[model samples]
Target: MDAIRIQTSAITRPSINLHTNPSGISFMKDKLLETDKSVFSVFGPNLGHYADDIIIVFKCEISPHPDANFSIQAATSFVSGNAFVLRPWLGKDPGSLDE
Candidate 1:
């Protein structure tokens, strides 16, 4: 079942890309598509694994705006992860992140 588990993990969890900036210093504020954890939670269950937790990369391939949130919506959607949870958060608060 290890293979199944690994495959599930690989399929469920979205792959994150980290790249360097022209300044040679990386910053996370980039590529944050979602700002809500609840979205990831729901995305987890459908992924065949309990939503133990979400990992927010402090730095992403793209740079974040000064007022951007940590969650990246594209990360979840593209990976078939969790972009739904972000819908509500986006409706109410555009840049809200828990912890």
Candidate 2:
């Protein structure tokens, strides 16, 4: 939709990389900053795990998204709440249950 097109157009396309190291995430990110001649930072590691399930959050501005229903740029809590249903599950310890 228009939202994706606008966001993708404004967002920089990550450059081609040959390194297969898991840190290639960092390399692609570094290239983005390098191309812009600025320092890039990693806020923290492993939102869930080091798998591709990891997500990167860049605090950038977006024009009011028609689907976002927000007058301002989306915030983490706001976006997460709208996008996912968060719940906590209590699981028995495997060892205890086996005993």
lDDT, each prediction: 0.39, 0.35
User: Model 1, range 1-99, lDDT digits (tens) per residue?
Assistant: 999999988865543221222211122422353223222323223443423356554456434566543444444343332444446554433333431
TM-score, cand. 2: 0.15
Q: Which lDDT tens digits does candidate 2 get at residues 65-87?
A: 54322322112222234212332
Root mean square deviation (Cα) for candidate 1: 13.5
Candidate 1, residue 86: lDDT? 49
